[model samples]
Target: MTAPGTDAPSTSAQDDVLFTGVVVYSTQDPEASAVLVSGGMVAWIGPTETAEGLHPGARRIDATGCLLTPGFVDCLPTADGAAVDDAWRASAASRGITGAVPGSAGIREGMRVLSPVAEPLPLKDLSAQGVPLAFGSLGAEDALDPWSWVRAAAHGGDPAQRISDRAAFLASTRAGLRLLDVPHPGALNLGVEATLVVWEPWDFTVHSSDIRTNAWSVDPRSRTPMLPDLTEGAPRALRTLVRGEIVHDVPGALG
Candidate 1:
């Protein structure tokens, strides 16, 4: 039997990705430390020696004095871009966080995410249309297929997955934004019925720009224009500037 909040009951005992060892983060702790991940979620975290001593046959990763932090979480006011909520949950689960909510008004993206598994049913609109469906709306516009995006964003990625392709969605959103002006920092997605909130975290020292706003920046509303808001760029930018490493692989929202 699985323990509470530990691992779900597995009918087949399969070898899963196990991250056992120290973890460094920009939040909760600044110094180097240890962490543990199982089934893509952070099951335990502690000092290096403690985390290391937990399990055997696990992937022993040396933080090598790298900075670790909870994934950057930007609420409504900041751009809660894609590839984060999915990617973080997978890898960061091993570090310490399992799930994070994304804040935005891009419901269409959610639909796209579920399109492949099923015939993209609009759960919400379905109720209105008097249609019954099982499953909730999935947002995948800014979000990419996890494994696909990872490969695309990783070294020698396929150019087809570039952010430029997302410009089409931006174009459509821009047209919508014209009818609905962008919201203020505190109030985003004002006209929209349901907006998703995105939470983004950083792996290294984050800067003011990481969550701060700029002229083109708006808050609380789903990010429009297919491009990441000014604040969204900061996390990936700072991560690289700080450690010369790529945590989320900087899924470029815009060129």
Candidate 2:
């Protein structure tokens, strides 16, 4: 993978890559620790030991102390009339955003709201009512950092109206993709396009709107995927991959 802010070296579709010793966040296999990408798609995902037996010649990426998850998708409008370009894409990739749908029109079946909402609308209630709510950035530049919207929605507004951090995260990722009617909205799974982001390790906690349910939610049996502890601030992206191709990487991140 190339370093951040530089164009990624061209890679063949047949190239194979094995990422080991990383925490993989996937709905299909929450406990997975390794992923093998082949032909620009997810070939296999499971325990690191199992991955060792597959794709013997695949390039290896020792991603210990990292969290691998689906990249964020941004639904944003132009920034001060500036169109989305390579620089903007690089900036977004650096922040763990892999795909974007420019402009705010034609987004039905789900609600897309700007963050730091000036008016507190019963967001949690709307979600509970099956509104399929999602968040967008106020400006194109701010859109790059998906956590900004997550933080604003999860922690802002009246306590009763605030959504849980997990809910906010879903709105920023899968929910946005669902709004666009993309097949298999979220990117993590076997045989899906390997659009992913590896983030610096950070603390995580299971958050819920109800204090009574918080304890049970953290139980291992729940198989819940913990998200970054927003109170400690958002984790930085160490690398970003689009369809298994390295689009951005922080220098020495894997070393």
Candidate 3:
């Protein structure tokens, strides 16, 4: 797809693009540090050491000190009556949002999108009951940052009812994709569309709901991929790619 706000030609799907030195957040391979996108699909994911050798002539993007994850899907409406045009899509892509189900579309599809308003819903309880919960901005006029919704869901409401950071992140990403029946449902596995975001480096930790547990859940034994520490504030998106094509890129982010 053509990048928003740019008349420049789009990247050809036949071209190979390799991103190295990134912390890839993939459930299928949590330790992956590099990714190869070929023909608009995820061709490979593994350690950085093997990337260059496997794809010798691929265009390389040095993503050192960055975290790469599936692009977020917005489950809320944009500014009231805002046209879903290139400008709007460009703004959302800058914030790592790749897709959306705005306004009545979400409700019509039976997707539960909770607004970040006073008197929060019982997120943890609803999540425990297999109720798929997705959090969004307070209103149409609110900023279109998915991280804010994640933070609200993870830390708002009754202390006992707050969801874990990981859960909230998934709700903002994979859950929305699944609800919309998007192919592969937000995963970065081989052959899947390479729609993702590269984020500025940030501290990360595994979150736990248990009060007795240590504040930082860094045990490798858990085998859980680490997520950005919301306590330290949200990380900025350096680049956003849709189907292996650059949609938004911050200057000097690839260096």
Candidate 4:
């Protein structure tokens, strides 16, 4: 994130000429322009500005600039269990936002700590260092897996294989949250790993590639693949995918 601009603080954008320049703003529609922002919030909008008595303090900024709308501020959790905060709160705040929320399994207080950090980490040090954590069911090491694997371990457990998926963890977490569940997501320390992969391991061997690839699974912010509209009818991908028939056969169809 670009550091917040350093300049004179403004009580308001109008009346004082802090900076003045052509600015463009947009809406959900790609071809739509809604309101124009001045200092940080939306200022004058619609039909393009031709206002009188422009503020001298206003710095001239180009309106030809493409609008970079902020991401959707998720006010709720994706799953039924806890409240989830965005994964990039720190970076977002560096850009200006003050409020943040996160929700994920085992992100609650007093969970176990496990990780591949070279530095030895105990429970106390992990929490202090803002380490990624999981529920009591999983140690820090288990949380670091493919998204499906993490969710499976976090939500469920498999004693036969000694493997627990995120779904199992999620169930445990929900049960843990019988009272006031402080919903928050865990940390994702991947940016540095990406750097290492780029600069250090250009010639990664098959074994090394396997190790790096096993570093972590794709961390999709969303928990599940959004199915298409049910109203849009069934998808064609389920060829020979027997969905048990309710009636023996449709009125006009052959079995």
Against the true structure, what is each candidate's TM-score?
Answer: 0.26, 0.87, 0.87, 0.24
CA deviation > 4 Å runs, candidate 2: 1-13, 78-82, 105-107, 116-119, 140-144, 185-187
Best by TM-score: 2
184 Cα displacement, candidate 2 (Å): 2.5
Which run of 10 residues does model 4 get worst, by summed lDDT?
192-201
For residues 56-141, what per-residue lDDT tens digits would candidate 3 score against the true structure?
99988888868888888775554353556677679988999987755532343555676644337787887788777665553445
Better of 1 and 3 by lDDT: 3
What order do candidates take by TM-score, descending? 2, 3, 1, 4
**Candidate that beats the other on TM-score, 1 or 4, i.e. the better one:** 1
The per-candidate count of clashes, in order, stands at 36, 0, 0, 48
Tens digits of per-residue lDDT for model 4, 202-246: 111111112343234222232221111122221111000001101
Candidate 4 runs further than 4 Å off: 1-25, 28-35, 38-41, 47-59, 71-90, 94-98, 105-255
List the global CA lDDT of all models: 0.28, 0.74, 0.74, 0.24
